[model samples]
Target: MNKQDYDIIVMGGGLAGCSSAIQLRSQGQRVLLLEQQRYPVHKLCGEFLSVEVISSFARLGILEAVRKAGAHPITRTYLTTSNGASLESELPGVGLGLSRYQLDLLLFQRAQELGADCLDGTKVNSVSGGLQQGFMVNTSQGNFSSRLVLGCHGKRSTLDLSRPFTGQYNPFVAFKGHYTGIALPGVIELHAFPGGYCGLSQIETGEINLCWIAHEKILNCKNSTLPDPLWQNPVLAARLHSMQCVRKSQHRLSQISFALKGKFDADVCMIGDSAGMITPFCGDGMAMALQSAEMAIPLVTGFLQGNLSERDLKRQYTSIWNREFRTRLQIGRLLHASFINAGIANLGVSLCDTFPALARGFIQATRGRDHGANLATSDI
Candidate 1:
């Protein structure tokens, strides 16, 4: 292949893209990672990584580095409803909290170290062609070709506009910010308001990350201040009152769709949120992103190595994706819908409070199985 060509091209430098590039490069495949923004930037993410990701991080050889970067273990979860009813549950396994700014940089550097071609601040304008003829990728930097392409561009992107499975648009907007002074050690909290919910957890830097997802109409009514609805939940109110925003400006993202998306488009495979997005309060998005990248490796590698046909690759990937995530996404959507309505939200919280075992089961259901745990014991 020429210098500009690669065996694989991964668009977006988020968890899925970076991890895919790193793993593919490690397998002796030439990989190019195109990222639109430079690293060390804030993203509108909850910053809470579920225990499920620990295995993927370990497989990628960045587990220790992530911990070294200040990720703190989270074993408890606190949830509150709009009506002030609340409950706490011990997580099935430990989660880690680390800001996207730090986590993205770490993964990008690791991919580069493994010899993957990384183009930060470069945007992918369009992708054309397919597996039969390879792919012609046009980008801000230059044009390139690859035998395969992975779409890890995340929940909302221009790339998605041209895709076929761009389901009904969701009107949700999300905001995130890091703050100091509000501390909830070893715990991640989800506080439900009238129209949305906020998640609070401590990242590796001991700074609390507050991320919320809500309908645009709900935010528009706030008129440039914290929403009055959040104050209805006393726990959420006290946490917000005590914290001071660390950034000059909070990171905001709009038009986030939680609608299920297609997994494959002929030759191109979609990973992470580009594949599907879970409701935010599930606290499993980051884990899902990493796992999607991990899942892509075998199918992509098999296709590249001529061990699998293109049709088989797509079929297998789609099957695996649905088997692993379809139920979780469905449950997350149902949960999000319930939490958004004040009456249902209160009833749901009250039920959880009344039945702690049910709450634990619900958490486990949303998280899916911890592949990391199985991988740790396997000889593979």
Candidate 2:
């Protein structure tokens, strides 16, 4: 019944949306941050933030808060194959493991403190119009207008109807759960199996987060044990057979990767997995989600201030994202192809042992660090 407008309207209240809202509020912009779910809701995620992300957290003034909220520091990452061969590498900086439930709530609360209107249980139905002045958002609560809209709604949602373009739909499903008995590596650990890889890490509450991304076909055929036929390699099949006793808390499909385009195009900037997602094998997706908000803030702010146009904002955002993540995404894509290749996987591990620096570089790249870049190696 009432129409309240803000400088910007941010849909999805996860890490990226909250981060963007906080940044905008800090610049004295009026912002409305909406979330379909209430605070402290859990989502299926790896729960590990890489060192690159921790650095951003410190700069954003939330590192201390994250620790005080019970997040645990992880200093290293360990990777093991089904054949039992393993490689371990120290992160160039400290990483942390914390559930999305806690992390998102922390970010949301911070945004509220900074003056963003935080709306929970508000499901956005659709958005219509462009970036010049503002667009009308149709939600369950009615209509609202804002010049810029940000999508941070995670992997799957019905909001794609509001956009003009969508990318190819992937058919993979990601299942995640939290368990208590497993002693995760002091850092994030990845165990590769056929059809997919699983990330295991210890989160703040002393529980281990286990997440697996596999083909939907593999999941559908399994009766008791996960189906082996879907796995392209014998190594992945062997690993799945071994996880019989690991408990599960939640199971869901991570949406196929997609992005918004058209007149609705760059008018709305999508953040987090809503823009694009990376395989979780590297433990950098969530970090990239948060960091992307940081990178987009200045451009968005400038656009709002008339210092930059929508075209410039979109160009800048795309350029920064590509510069920062394109290579890593490409490398991840190459690695995904080998997960099912026994010869290549084995050869890869052998290579890591022969050239430790090269292995470190690969790990760094997986964590979204550019190759040959020098980032601080620390755990604080």
- Using TM-score as the measure, the top candidate is 1
Question: lDDT of candidate 2?
Answer: 0.72
TM-score of each: 0.94, 0.86
**Please, what is the whole-model Cα lDDT of each candidate in the order they appear?**
0.85, 0.72
Residue lDDT tens for model 1, 16-123: 899899889889998999999988788889999887888788889898798778688887899898787888887776788898999999999999999998989999
TM-score of 1: 0.94
The runs of at least 3 residues in candidate 2 whose Cα sits more than 4 Å from the true structure, single-residue gaps closed, are 1-4, 161-169, 223-248, 258-266, 367-380
Candidate 1 ranges with C-alpha deviation above 4 Å: 1-4, 164-167, 222-225, 371-380
Q: Estimate, for each residue in 236-347, the C-alpha lDDT of model 2 and write its tens digit.
A: 3443444433343565665455333221244678887777767666667877788789888898889877899777888888888888777777777677657545456667
| Candidate 2 RMSD to the real structure | 4.0
| Candidate 1 backbone overlaps, count | 1
Q: For each candidate, C-alpha RMSD in Å?
A: 3.0, 4.0
Tell me how far the alpha carbon of residue 37 in candidate 1 is from the true structure, in angstroms, after superposition: 0.3
